[model samples]
Target: MIHKLVTTPMNLVIKVGEKVKEEADKELYDLPTIQQKLIQLQMMYELGEISEDAFKEKEEELLIRYEVAKKKEFEQWEELTKKKD
Candidate 1:
């Protein structure tokens, strides 16, 4: 009974941490969020709020992230399809 009391709280904490990490990943790697960021960055450049070099650097980062997000999304879809079959 004592062991269960100790381990049960630890297990709940671990599950909560995992859920938080999953949510954070989804927000970070979300396709629409990345695209919106890119659009905002371009607007900043066009409006003279950011320099060409800075804009290019940020754009490249966003592009790379977009590609990774796209690949992840595709893989997730594939997994879902496989599960259904």
Candidate 2:
């Protein structure tokens, strides 16, 4: 009936939002991926594949990106907590 029609669309929208949030969570809190990139940068520097300046520059960029990701993660956690309460 009308109730079913109304709730169906609402449910679909909620489910879609949940899926998007899950995907975002993966990208935002992906620590392992960040760590691997850091390791690669270190290896490149140690192997003399890149100069000190390049290494420092890349490392700084990566660290900044990690910081932003951590911020996003924190914000997302707070949002979820608020929703639960």
Candidate 3:
């Protein structure tokens, strides 16, 4: 069975954000993408795979890469959606 969402106009952005977040969550653990690496860094930090200083360093690096990747993905999505408008 398929479920449906009942979103109003004002909730459109929220819905999209949730969808994007869901996609990001899925990709975070699947491979060695930026988000995946970020997930790894987070796990390492939590599980003591690296020192606090090392974890902080890798986390910062991964975060920067994640932001860049996320921006690119958003731009591509925006381009595609805008073309349909």
Lowest lDDT block of 10, candidate 3: 1-10
Across residues 1-85, which tens digit of lDDT does each residue of candidate 2 receive? 9999999999999999999998986765587787789999999999999999999999998898788778887998999999999
Query: Model 3, 1-85: lDDT tens per residue?
Result: 1233544654888899999998976565333587667777788888988899998888887677667667777887999999999
lDDT per residue (tens digit) for residues 1-85 in model 1: 9999999999999999999999998888999999999999999999999999999999999999999999999999999999999
| Cα RMSD, model 2 | 5.2
Screening candidate 1 with a backbone cut-off below 3 angstroms (N, C-alpha, C), the clashing residue pairs are none
Better of 2 and 3 by TM-score: 2
Task: Report the number of the highest-lDDT candidate.
Answer: 1
- The regions of model 2 sitting more than 4 angstroms off are 1-29
Better of 1 and 2 by TM-score: 1
- lDDT of each model, Cα atoms only? 0.97, 0.89, 0.75
Give candidates' CA RMSD values in order: 1.1, 5.2, 10.6
Query: How are the candidates ranked when ordered by lDDT, highest leading?
Result: 1, 2, 3
